[model samples]
Target chain A: MRSEEYLQKYHGVTKFLRILAQISFWLVVVLGAASLALGVATLFMSSDSFTFNFLDNIRLSMDGVLQFDLSLANITATTKKEIITTILFALSSFAIIYGLIISQLTSFLKTVENGMPFASANVKRLNMIGILFIVGSFIINTVYGLVANKIIHALGISTLSVNLQSDANMLFMGIIIIILAGIFRYGSYLQDEYDATI
Target chain B: MAIILRLDRMLADRKMQQNDLAEKVGISVVNLSNIKTGKVKAIRFSTLDAICRELKCQPGDILEYQAE
Candidate 1:
């Protein structure tokens, strides 16, 4: 059948989900950049010199060499912990909000797959919600950075050495976030194409 | 939510069997039954056009709006 033959309205929820998905995509972009910058900066020094930069600065207490004779192994252990924590923080926040949006989107998509036409406004609303999430993530990152700096000064670690181990981990996470965001955005585009074909 | 499909009405007025209508429209008997019973969540334009053309009726004739 010709695509133009279908004249039903777009579902409200489906549109909202698309927009939300796109917004998260952008959030990943901004967060990725900030994470990379901070991570790279920290790699130049030890936790003592790193000072508080965010909630992560609290981890400075873990500084100091391990008993392991292999220097590489010791450093690897510490770095692994920091990387895991950073990724967990990012993934958890996104998961919570995205989960809600995804549920709604899935419901809407099912209806659409059945050949129902939804209202145009509903699609626009979904788009707006996604954008809001993207903006919210950026704001959160900024707040985290500000708080981290204040805490570092309060702890008198401002003049200390940079935490090379933690910084390396952060840098890796930043790169990952950016890449994930791109992949997600691409997914959305594919969804649109799929819908159109249908 | 209270909109009623007048498919049965059309079928009766045209004195056509459900099976014959389904075959003529190139749709399955199950789907035709769903439409007749208002169990369908949606109707594609192509499907609507096919039914209308076959039955010699308009969409308005088969769709009725009723307040909930």
Candidate 2:
């Protein structure tokens, strides 16, 4: 199909994606706020044995490094507090990064909806998201792993062998996005050429 | 770019304004201005043909090359 036809066909798709991104952005905001409230609430509660069921569901166990004893009955207050702190850290970071990602996606889709998909704005947004993925993935996982190890030591589980692996999927996805941004940059260059040409 | 546009000189030689050339060549004055100022990365063959026809000049008259 011709360029105009292709754009016409996908214009609806971009619009739909923009709407989805907007919804996801707000959801992230609301959920992130709730998590912050919950974390703060737990801090004031004067009990270590008192573990939230939802917190229990969000497991951050590494392979043989740190294992969460899901049986909240057996967990010490210090261990529980440490785990909660770690989870809050991870989740807050995720919400922030994810919020940024969704916002960038919304902006990109808006550009596409306006028939400027190859504009430099979209390229920059993609690059920003790509960098966020790469850096955030490494920092969050490594920090979580380290904090978990500290918890293991605190609990004196010296017998459990520690093995922490970086999230390969997110790293790969970040690399792919950066590559795509490069391609979009080239497309933007061509667009400039086309537009400037008489 | 190595390929330089001499459209400004050609327009001068023809004593023609950008508006006249753009109207005659069926292109916007902005595009003709870009060509005259060497702001465009390339000229499409159809546009080159149109410009040439309107200017009554050869493509070589509007285009030149110089090593940087």
Candidate 3:
């Protein structure tokens, strides 16, 4: 309340939202990746192996949630179906993770725009974002390794072996962010004490 | 916590309403109430000056130090 006048006059919430919107616009890349994956799956995969049970499970879940009828069963190709299925699975997993990250960021930014960056809600958001990033990167890495191995086998490329490795950079960054969230929570507690004191 | 506000007592002795004193002191009623209820961590000198001037009392008459 003491700095309300300065905050209201200089801190434009709309401006921040605009910038966030611009950045979030790049999320279109996820859609592009999904489309590209779908195309590649159609080109390389045989019809039988392309609709693996796991892939069908994913499709069925997605269909139930999104109410969309994806007709992947119509393809008559007989080669590289497993590879295609793996690629599509990886892409879909990445898209979901990216969506979660974006949603968390949007909510966190809104709280910041409200001029309470150290609020408990923002702290929780930060923690959630951090955990999501960590878990997401791990999942992506595992999926990528699986897809790579599947593709190698499909292509009869026996010389290469896929190794499972976590994204170290994302893991480290997530840990730092989680620590920052904890610090922010402490700051929020202090802010609450200060606000209540007066 | 050791510092207690005697604002309610002072207001009674001066026969002044909280609303009237808040207006005279140029602060919101909520702020004045916070001060009266000893909820404020600190008071600005300007606000204290205005309150003392309006209430026709010294600072000592409004604030008292008590051991916790």
| TM-scores (chain A) of the candidates | 0.31, 0.79, 0.67
Query: Which stretches of model 2 miss by more than 4 angstroms?
Result: A48-86, A139-163, B1-17, B64-68
Instruction: Pull out the clashing pairs in model 2.
Output: none
- 2 versus 3: better lDDT goes to: 2
Query: Each model: TM-score of chain B?
Result: 0.96, 0.93, 0.97
Q: Cα RMSD (Å) per model?
A: 13.9, 4.6, 8.9
- TM-score of predicted structure 2: 0.72
Q: By descending TM-score, how would the candidates be arranged?
A: 2, 3, 1
Per-model i-RMS? 7.1, 1.2, 3.1
Give the CA lDDT, 0 to 100, for residue A59 in model 3.
34
Tell me the fnat of candidate 1.
Answer: 0.00
lDDT of 3 by residue, B12-39 (tens): 9999999999988888899899999998
CA-lDDT, candidates in order: 0.56, 0.80, 0.73
lDDT of candidate 1 over B31-50, digit per residue (tens) = 89888988777777888889
Q: After superposition, how far is residue A9 of candidate 1 from its true place, in Å?
A: 23
Q: Give the alpha carbon lDDT tens digit for every residue of A79-195 in model 2.
A: 677666666665666788788889998998998888888998878999998998888778767766776676666556777545566678888999999999999999999888777
DockQ of each: 0.05, 0.61, 0.43
